[model samples]
Target: MNESLHGGVGKAQIKLRTQDFPIKEFVCQHDPLYIRALFLQAKTEFLLLSLDLTSLTESMVYDLKASVYEEFNIPIENIWITVTHTFSAPHLDKSYPIFIKKVKEAVQLSVSRALERVTKLAISTDSVTTSLNCSRNIETPFGWWLGRNDLEYSNHDIRILKIYEIKTDHLLCVLFNGDLPPSVMADSYLEQGGKAVSSDLIGYTCRKLEETVTQTAIFILGAAGDQRPLEKSCEDIVSEECLKRNDLHEAGFKLVETQGDRLYEEICSSLVKPNPIFLPIKAISIYEKKVFLEEKVMPIPTKELKPTKHFDFSKTGRQQELTIAGVSLGSIVLLGIQPEVNSLFGEKLRELVNVQTVFIASMVNGAIKYLPEEKDFERVTYTAMNTQLGRGSSKQFLEEVRRFLKESNLSVDKQIN
Candidate 1:
C-alpha cells in the first residue's frame, strides 16, 4: 500500500429535500425525509462520503460508485456510502422514472458542491450525559434467545463532535448520534408522501446543534438495529406520526440553543484558534480472518429463520477485529459486533485504543446488528436473542481485535489483551 499517501481531510455538507421514498411496500406509499451528503476528502482526493438518505436500494451504492469513478476518477474502494437510515425518506428502489432521475440529480448536486468547497479544519469533542435506552432481549434455555423491540432499551449515550475552522471561529461539522430506529412513519405512509423530504432526527439534531455552534453539523445514525421508540406503540401509529414531525422541528431549535452554548464554552476553554497545538493522529486497521458462516461447523438453516427478538449462542473461537482510527481531533472505528451495541462495547473499544483524552465514535464503516456480551446475550431480547448470526461471532470479533493490533505492530498493553 502507499503508506506515503498523505491524508488531507476536507468535508462538505449539502442539504436536499428532507423526504425520500424510493421503494413502496404496498401499491401506494409516501416518502417523508429529505437527504443530505457529508463529503470527506483526503489530500484533495476522495476518501469517504456519508450519504444521509431517507432510504434506497442496495444497488444504488454500486451505481453511485460507478458514476463517481467515471466522473471524478477516484477509486471505488476509497468511497464509503452510509444512510442515516431515516425511515421518513424516499425509497429509490420503487420510485418512478422521474423520481429516480430526481434522486440521481440531487446526489450529484450534493457531491459536486461538497467537492468544490473543501477546506482544512480542526475538530473538537464533547459529550452529553447518557440517555435512558438499552437492549431488550436475552437467551433462552434451548440455546437460543428471544426479546422485543423496546425504546427504553435504546443506547441513549451519544457524543458530540465539533468541527472548527483552524483560523476562523466558524463551525464545519456537528456530528451526533441518530440511533433512533428508522420508523418515523410506517412504510405504508413513507412510499406515498413527498412534501418536504429531509433527514429526520439526524437532520434535526444537526440543525439544532448548528444554531449555537456557528458551524455545520452532520448527524450519523449509530448502532440502532433493535432500538425503537417506546412511545411508538403497536395500536397507535398516529402518536408516532405526530411526535416525529414535532421532534424534528423542536429538536432542531432546542439543540442549537442548549447544546450550542454548552459546546461553545467547552471548546473555548479547552481549545485555541488559528493553529492550536496539533493533536495526535493515530490510524490503526485490524482485519480478523475467520470462516464465513457458510463454512461454519453447524449447518445454517436452509430457509431464513423466523424473526426472533432474543439473541444467544453456543459457538467458540471466532475472529473479528475492533479497529480504531484515532486522529488528533477524535476517534473513528469499526465496531466488531452487532448493531445494538451497548456501553460495554464502547468501553471495551476505548480500553483497546487506550486514548487518554479523546471522544469515542463508532460504526464508522458498516453495521452489524446489536451485540451484548456473552452473559447478557443469554438474557435474550429482540437484538441479542434473535440474531441470525451466531453467538460465536462476538468472541470471533474480540479475538480479531487482538489479532488486528498485533498485526498492525501497534504495541498492545497487557491490560487491554
Candidate 2:
C-alpha cells in the first residue's frame, strides 16, 4: 500500500524558517511533498508512515495515532511515524488542519490498499558510505555555534532496509536511514533570492530510486541534530556562474541532482552485491517508556548590536520529557526516540546492542529540541544550550534501550525453546 499526495504548495501565510533565516515567499515547487506509508501484517501488525515535512508536534502525533487505531485495529504502539526533516517545506503549524487531515486520509487509504494486496515478505538490510553529511557545530570563542565545522564528528553510514514480494521478487519498500537533511545542500538558494519550496535532497534521492526501480522509497532520519550536508563553497558557487539570471536556482537544482545521483548509484551498488541473509519472521515485541527530563532555565544571549549592559543573557525553559519506543523485528530492532538526537548517542547504542542491525529513528514522536551527549554539554554547543535534558540523560536513555533489547531477545529465545 504505497501512495503519495501533495503535502502542500505555494508560500505559507506564516514562515518558521530554519536557523531564523527569513524568506519572503515560496517561489516554486520542485516536486510534490509526499506522505508515504508501508503497512506490514505478520504475527503482529505494524504500520510505518514517512513524511516530507520538518517535524510533527506531539498533539498531532496523538491525534494521528488515535485516528489510526480507531480506523484499523492496530495498536498505538505499533504505529511509527517519522519525518525526513527537510527544511524547505512549509511550517507544519501553517499547514496544519488541512495538512494533517490529508495525512490521516492517506494513511487510511494506504491501509485499505495494503489489505487488498497482501503478500509474503522477505526483508534484508544493507549499508553504504557516502560523503553527504558533516558536523555543523563550529567552535567559537563565545561558544560552540551552529555552523559548518570540519573537526566535529559526523555519521556517513546510509543504512537501507529492503522489503520484497516473496513470489515475484519485486521490491515492496526501501527504508533508507541517514543523518543528513535534503535542505543542507540547497540552503544557498535561499540566500541568493531563491524562493522555491522543494523537498531538496531527500526528495531527489527518493525520486531517482523510484525511477530506477518500481518500489516505494521511504527515508528515515537518524541522529542528525549536529549534522548537515557538505555544501558547495562560495568559490564553487562562483565557478558555476550562479550570478547569471536565476542560475542560482539552476545550480541548486543541479547540486541536488548530483548528490541524489551519487546516493542512488551507491544504493544500486550495494543492492547488486551479495544479498544479505534474511532474518526469520518472529512475533513482534513492542516496548515504550517515557523518561522525565529534568527541566533547567538556560541563559539565552542577547540580540543587541553591542553589549552595553553587564547582563547579556536571558533565561528560557527547555524540554521536560523524553519518549523512547522500540519494536523488535526478528534480528532487526527499530528504536524510535523523540526529538532531535546527536549521532554519538546512536553510535553508543549500536555498540552496546551488538546486533546485526539497529535502526535508530530520531525525531520520531515529536520535536523537543536537541538531545546532546553528556560530554557535549561541557563545550556549551548549540545543541547543548538548546537541549532540555541535563547531563547523563543520554546515558539513561541508552540504558533503557539496552534493557528493552535484552528482555526482548530473551523473550524470543524462550518462545523458540
Per-model CA lDDT versus the true structure? 0.43, 0.66
Clashes per model (N, Cα, C within 3 A) = 73, 1
lDDT score of residue 372 within candidate 2: 67
Cα lDDT for residue 298, candidate 1: 27
- lDDT digits (tens) for residues 1-417 of candidate 1: 112122222333332332422334322222223334444433434334455454333367667767767876766655555566655444554435555666566556556655666555554455554332344333333332223334334545455555555545466655555344433332222223322244443445444555555445555555555454322212121231231222332223333244334434433343244443333333333332232321112223423332333323555455333233322212344323223355445555445654443233334334434454555455443344434456655555555555554554433354434
Per-prediction TM-score, please?
A: 0.62, 0.80
Q: What is the C-alpha RMSD of each candidate to the true structure, in Å?
A: 7.9, 7.7
* RMSD to native, candidate 2: 7.7
Candidate 2, after superposition: displacement of residue 178 in Å? 2.1
Question: Taking the tens digit of each residue's C-alpha lDDT, what string does model 2 give over 170-235?
Answer: 776778898876764334454545556667788888877776774678888888888877764211
- TM-score of candidate 2 on Cα atoms, chains taken together: 0.80
